[model samples]
Target: MIFAIETAALQTFDGAFADELFLVARILFGGVIAFIGLNHFLNLEEMAGYAEYKGAPAPTLSVGASGVVLVLGGLAVALGAFPTLAAGALAGFLVVATPMMHDFWAVPEDQRQDELNSFLKNVGLLGMTVLLLAVSTVEWPYAVGVGLV
Candidate 1:
Protein backbone atom coordinates (compact mmCIF):
# COMPACT_ATOMS: atom_id res chain seq x y z
CA MET A 1 0.00 0.00 0.00
CA ILE A 2 2.75 2.41 0.91
CA PHE A 3 4.71 1.55 -2.23
CA ALA A 4 1.65 2.08 -4.36
CA ILE A 5 1.05 5.45 -2.74
CA GLU A 6 4.63 6.52 -3.43
CA THR A 7 4.38 5.47 -7.06
CA ALA A 8 1.13 7.31 -7.48
CA ALA A 9 2.62 10.42 -5.95
CA LEU A 10 5.52 10.30 -8.38
CA GLN A 11 3.16 9.88 -11.31
CA THR A 12 1.14 12.83 -10.16
CA PHE A 13 4.25 14.99 -9.98
CA ASP A 14 5.31 13.93 -13.44
CA GLY A 15 1.89 14.65 -14.86
CA ALA A 16 1.93 18.12 -13.31
CA PHE A 17 5.34 18.82 -14.81
CA ALA A 18 4.16 17.72 -18.22
CA ASP A 19 1.06 19.88 -17.96
CA GLU A 20 3.15 22.91 -17.06
CA LEU A 21 5.40 22.38 -20.07
CA PHE A 22 2.39 22.04 -22.36
CA LEU A 23 0.88 25.22 -20.99
CA VAL A 24 4.12 27.14 -21.51
CA ALA A 25 4.54 25.97 -25.09
CA ARG A 26 0.92 26.59 -25.92
CA ILE A 27 1.02 30.13 -24.56
CA LEU A 28 4.24 31.01 -26.38
CA PHE A 29 3.03 29.69 -29.71
CA GLY A 30 -0.39 31.25 -29.31
CA GLY A 31 1.13 34.59 -28.37
CA VAL A 32 3.27 34.56 -31.50
CA ILE A 33 0.24 33.88 -33.66
CA ALA A 34 -1.69 36.61 -31.93
CA PHE A 35 1.13 39.10 -32.46
CA ILE A 36 1.44 38.25 -36.14
CA GLY A 37 -2.29 38.51 -36.58
CA LEU A 38 -2.37 41.88 -34.91
CA ASN A 39 0.42 43.04 -37.18
CA HIS A 40 -1.62 41.97 -40.19
CA PHE A 41 -4.64 43.85 -38.91
CA LEU A 42 -2.63 46.96 -38.12
CA ASN A 43 -0.75 47.00 -41.43
CA LEU A 44 -3.43 46.12 -43.92
CA GLU A 45 -1.49 47.56 -46.82
CA GLU A 46 1.59 45.53 -46.02
CA MET A 47 -0.44 42.38 -45.63
CA ALA A 48 -2.26 43.13 -48.85
CA GLY A 49 1.08 43.38 -50.58
CA TYR A 50 2.05 40.05 -49.12
CA ALA A 51 -1.23 38.59 -50.29
CA GLU A 52 -0.58 39.89 -53.78
CA TYR A 53 2.89 38.39 -53.71
CA LYS A 54 1.24 35.08 -52.78
CA GLY A 55 -1.10 35.37 -55.75
CA ALA A 56 -4.14 35.46 -53.55
CA PRO A 57 -7.32 37.24 -54.66
CA ALA A 58 -8.76 40.18 -52.81
CA PRO A 59 -5.55 40.82 -50.96
CA THR A 60 -7.09 42.99 -48.32
CA LEU A 61 -9.89 40.53 -47.63
CA SER A 62 -7.55 37.57 -47.50
CA VAL A 63 -5.27 39.39 -45.08
CA GLY A 64 -8.17 40.40 -42.88
CA ALA A 65 -9.59 36.87 -42.82
CA SER A 66 -6.26 35.32 -42.01
CA GLY A 67 -5.76 37.89 -39.28
CA VAL A 68 -9.08 37.08 -37.71
CA VAL A 69 -8.42 33.34 -37.84
CA LEU A 70 -5.02 33.79 -36.26
CA VAL A 71 -6.30 35.99 -33.48
CA LEU A 72 -9.17 33.70 -32.62
CA GLY A 73 -7.13 30.55 -32.90
CA GLY A 74 -4.36 32.03 -30.80
CA LEU A 75 -6.76 33.09 -28.11
CA ALA A 76 -8.33 29.64 -28.01
CA VAL A 77 -4.99 27.91 -27.82
CA ALA A 78 -3.70 30.26 -25.15
CA LEU A 79 -6.71 29.71 -22.98
CA GLY A 80 -6.93 25.96 -23.71
CA ALA A 81 -10.62 26.74 -23.73
CA PHE A 82 -11.27 24.13 -26.41
CA PRO A 83 -7.84 22.70 -26.95
CA THR A 84 -8.83 20.13 -29.52
CA LEU A 85 -10.86 22.44 -31.70
CA ALA A 86 -8.44 25.32 -31.36
CA ALA A 87 -5.39 23.24 -32.13
CA GLY A 88 -7.09 21.61 -35.09
CA ALA A 89 -8.05 25.00 -36.48
CA LEU A 90 -4.49 26.26 -36.05
CA ALA A 91 -3.12 23.19 -37.78
CA GLY A 92 -5.41 23.69 -40.76
CA PHE A 93 -4.60 27.39 -40.96
CA LEU A 94 -0.89 26.72 -40.80
CA VAL A 95 -1.17 24.15 -43.57
CA VAL A 96 -2.93 26.60 -45.86
CA ALA A 97 -0.82 29.62 -44.97
CA THR A 98 2.52 27.87 -45.16
CA PRO A 99 2.28 26.78 -48.76
CA MET A 100 0.07 29.59 -49.99
CA MET A 101 1.77 32.50 -48.31
CA HIS A 102 5.31 31.28 -47.76
CA ASP A 103 5.82 29.50 -51.10
CA PHE A 104 8.96 27.60 -50.26
CA TRP A 105 9.04 25.87 -53.65
CA ALA A 106 9.21 29.06 -55.70
CA VAL A 107 12.34 30.53 -54.15
CA PRO A 108 15.85 30.51 -55.67
CA GLU A 109 17.87 27.41 -54.79
CA ASP A 110 19.97 29.19 -52.18
CA GLN A 111 16.99 31.01 -50.71
CA ARG A 112 14.94 27.86 -51.07
CA GLN A 113 16.86 26.33 -48.18
CA ASP A 114 15.81 29.15 -45.87
CA GLU A 115 12.29 29.13 -47.18
CA LEU A 116 12.15 25.37 -46.71
CA ASN A 117 13.24 25.82 -43.16
CA SER A 118 10.37 28.22 -42.54
CA PHE A 119 7.97 25.86 -44.27
CA LEU A 120 9.13 22.93 -42.20
CA LYS A 121 8.86 24.97 -39.04
CA ASN A 122 5.29 25.81 -39.85
CA VAL A 123 4.62 22.16 -40.66
CA GLY A 124 6.10 21.16 -37.34
CA LEU A 125 3.95 23.74 -35.61
CA LEU A 126 0.93 22.23 -37.29
CA GLY A 127 1.92 18.78 -36.14
CA MET A 128 2.51 20.01 -32.62
CA THR A 129 -0.88 21.67 -32.54
CA VAL A 130 -2.53 18.50 -33.76
CA LEU A 131 -0.71 16.46 -31.18
CA LEU A 132 -1.66 18.93 -28.50
CA LEU A 133 -5.26 18.60 -29.53
CA ALA A 134 -5.17 14.83 -29.39
CA VAL A 135 -3.28 14.63 -26.14
CA SER A 136 -5.29 17.29 -24.37
CA THR A 137 -8.54 15.78 -25.50
CA VAL A 138 -7.50 12.26 -24.59
CA GLU A 139 -6.14 13.26 -21.23
CA TRP A 140 -9.16 15.30 -20.31
CA PRO A 141 -11.85 13.55 -22.21
CA TYR A 142 -14.42 14.29 -19.60
CA ALA A 143 -13.66 17.98 -19.70
CA VAL A 144 -13.86 18.01 -23.49
CA GLY A 145 -16.81 15.69 -23.59
CA VAL A 146 -19.96 17.10 -22.06
CA GLY A 147 -19.05 20.47 -20.63
CA LEU A 148 -16.12 20.77 -18.26
CA VAL A 149 -17.69 18.90 -15.51
Candidate 2:
Protein backbone atom coordinates (compact mmCIF):
# COMPACT_ATOMS: atom_id res chain seq x y z
CA MET A 1 0.00 0.00 0.00
CA ILE A 2 1.14 3.56 -0.53
CA PHE A 3 1.08 4.18 3.20
CA ALA A 4 3.16 1.09 3.81
CA ILE A 5 5.70 2.20 1.23
CA GLU A 6 5.90 5.70 2.67
CA THR A 7 6.17 4.37 6.18
CA ALA A 8 8.87 1.93 5.16
CA ALA A 9 10.77 4.62 3.30
CA LEU A 10 10.50 6.96 6.23
CA GLN A 11 11.61 4.30 8.67
CA THR A 12 14.88 6.22 8.85
CA PHE A 13 13.02 8.54 11.22
CA ASP A 14 11.43 7.63 14.53
CA GLY A 15 7.88 6.24 14.16
CA ALA A 16 6.65 9.13 16.26
CA PHE A 17 7.85 11.46 13.54
CA ALA A 18 5.23 10.16 11.16
CA ASP A 19 2.57 10.41 13.84
CA GLU A 20 3.55 13.98 14.58
CA LEU A 21 3.39 14.82 10.89
CA PHE A 22 -0.14 13.43 10.66
CA LEU A 23 -1.08 15.25 13.83
CA VAL A 24 0.13 18.48 12.38
CA ALA A 25 -1.79 17.86 9.20
CA ARG A 26 -4.99 17.24 11.11
CA ILE A 27 -4.43 20.28 13.28
CA LEU A 28 -3.84 22.52 10.30
CA PHE A 29 -6.83 21.15 8.49
CA GLY A 30 -8.99 21.60 11.54
CA GLY A 31 -7.68 25.08 12.08
CA VAL A 32 -8.68 26.03 8.56
CA ILE A 33 -12.17 24.66 9.08
CA ALA A 34 -12.46 26.55 12.31
CA PHE A 35 -11.27 29.74 10.68
CA ILE A 36 -13.87 29.67 7.92
CA GLY A 37 -16.60 28.61 10.29
CA LEU A 38 -15.68 31.37 12.70
CA ASN A 39 -15.59 33.76 9.79
CA HIS A 40 -19.22 32.98 9.18
CA PHE A 41 -19.94 34.34 12.64
CA LEU A 42 -17.69 37.37 12.31
CA ASN A 43 -19.47 38.36 9.09
CA LEU A 44 -22.89 37.17 10.03
CA GLU A 45 -24.72 40.20 8.71
CA GLU A 46 -22.89 40.24 5.39
CA MET A 47 -23.03 36.50 5.04
CA ALA A 48 -26.75 36.48 5.77
CA GLY A 49 -27.25 39.27 3.27
CA TYR A 50 -25.40 37.28 0.66
CA ALA A 51 -27.31 34.16 1.53
CA GLU A 52 -30.50 36.11 1.15
CA TYR A 53 -29.33 37.40 -2.20
CA LYS A 54 -28.74 33.79 -3.16
CA GLY A 55 -32.38 33.01 -2.32
CA ALA A 56 -31.71 30.98 0.76
CA PRO A 57 -34.86 31.01 2.88
CA ALA A 58 -34.47 32.41 6.39
CA PRO A 59 -30.96 33.46 5.50
CA THR A 60 -30.13 34.70 8.96
CA LEU A 61 -31.08 31.47 10.66
CA SER A 62 -29.48 29.40 7.94
CA VAL A 63 -26.15 31.17 8.24
CA GLY A 64 -26.17 30.93 12.00
CA ALA A 65 -26.94 27.20 11.98
CA SER A 66 -24.41 26.37 9.29
CA GLY A 67 -21.78 28.32 11.18
CA VAL A 68 -22.38 26.13 14.21
CA VAL A 69 -21.90 23.01 12.12
CA LEU A 70 -18.64 24.28 10.72
CA VAL A 71 -17.27 25.17 14.13
CA LEU A 72 -18.31 21.90 15.76
CA GLY A 73 -17.26 19.75 12.82
CA GLY A 74 -13.94 21.54 12.57
CA LEU A 75 -13.24 21.05 16.25
CA ALA A 76 -14.15 17.37 16.16
CA VAL A 77 -11.98 16.86 13.09
CA ALA A 78 -9.04 18.70 14.59
CA LEU A 79 -9.21 16.58 17.71
CA GLY A 80 -9.79 13.39 15.70
CA ALA A 81 -12.94 12.95 17.74
CA PHE A 82 -15.60 11.04 15.83
CA PRO A 83 -13.64 11.78 12.70
CA THR A 84 -15.89 9.91 10.26
CA LEU A 85 -18.92 11.80 11.44
CA ALA A 86 -17.02 15.04 11.62
CA ALA A 87 -15.48 14.63 8.22
CA GLY A 88 -18.68 13.31 6.76
CA ALA A 89 -20.54 16.32 8.13
CA LEU A 90 -17.94 18.62 6.65
CA ALA A 91 -18.14 16.86 3.28
CA GLY A 92 -21.91 17.03 3.29
CA PHE A 93 -21.84 20.70 4.22
CA LEU A 94 -19.43 21.55 1.44
CA VAL A 95 -21.35 19.52 -1.14
CA VAL A 96 -24.60 21.36 -0.46
CA ALA A 97 -23.06 24.77 0.10
CA THR A 98 -20.53 24.76 -2.77
CA PRO A 99 -23.13 24.45 -5.50
CA MET A 100 -25.56 26.85 -3.92
CA MET A 101 -23.00 29.52 -3.13
CA HIS A 102 -20.55 29.02 -5.98
CA ASP A 103 -22.74 28.54 -9.00
CA PHE A 104 -20.06 29.62 -11.45
CA TRP A 105 -22.22 28.82 -14.43
CA ALA A 106 -24.72 31.41 -13.32
CA VAL A 107 -22.17 34.15 -12.93
CA PRO A 108 -20.95 36.70 -15.46
CA GLU A 109 -17.82 35.89 -17.42
CA ASP A 110 -15.64 38.02 -15.19
CA GLN A 111 -16.88 36.38 -12.00
CA ARG A 112 -17.16 32.90 -13.46
CA GLN A 113 -13.54 31.99 -12.94
CA ASP A 114 -13.55 33.06 -9.32
CA GLU A 115 -16.73 31.19 -8.58
CA LEU A 116 -15.47 28.20 -10.45
CA ASN A 117 -12.28 28.23 -8.44
CA SER A 118 -14.27 28.34 -5.23
CA PHE A 119 -16.33 25.42 -6.43
CA LEU A 120 -13.20 23.46 -7.28
CA LYS A 121 -11.66 24.23 -3.93
CA ASN A 122 -14.76 22.95 -2.21
CA VAL A 123 -14.52 19.82 -4.30
CA GLY A 124 -10.96 19.29 -3.14
CA LEU A 125 -11.98 19.81 0.48
CA LEU A 126 -14.81 17.37 0.02
CA GLY A 127 -12.42 14.81 -1.38
CA MET A 128 -10.16 15.23 1.64
CA THR A 129 -13.11 14.82 3.98
CA VAL A 130 -14.13 11.63 2.22
CA LEU A 131 -10.56 10.43 2.30
CA LEU A 132 -10.48 11.06 6.02
CA LEU A 133 -13.63 9.03 6.35
CA ALA A 134 -12.07 6.19 4.40
CA VAL A 135 -8.65 6.12 6.03
CA SER A 136 -9.34 7.25 9.63
CA THR A 137 -9.48 4.52 12.27
CA VAL A 138 -10.52 6.57 15.30
CA GLU A 139 -13.54 5.34 17.19
CA TRP A 140 -16.65 7.45 17.52
CA PRO A 141 -16.72 9.40 20.72
CA TYR A 142 -20.46 9.02 21.32
CA ALA A 143 -21.13 5.92 19.24
CA VAL A 144 -19.41 2.95 17.56
CA GLY A 145 -16.70 4.13 15.11
CA VAL A 146 -13.10 3.74 13.82
CA GLY A 147 -9.89 5.94 13.42
CA LEU A 148 -7.08 7.33 15.68
CA VAL A 149 -5.97 10.83 16.59
lDDT of 2 by residue, 30-101 (tens): 788888899999999999999998788899998988898889888877787778778888988998899999
lDDT of each: 0.74, 0.78
lDDT of 1 by residue, 33-86 (tens): 788789888999987997897798899998899888888878777766666667
**RMSD of model 1, in Å?**
7.2
User: lDDT: which candidate is best?
Assistant: 2
Q: What is the lDDT of residue 93 in candidate 1?
A: 82
- Relative to the unseen true structure, what is the C-alpha lDDT of residue 64 in candidate 2, on a scale of 0 to 100? 87
Error of 2 at 41 (Å): 0.6
Which candidate tops TM-score? Answer: 2
Candidate 2 positional error at 117, Å:
1.6
Q: How many clashing pairs in candidate 1? A: 0
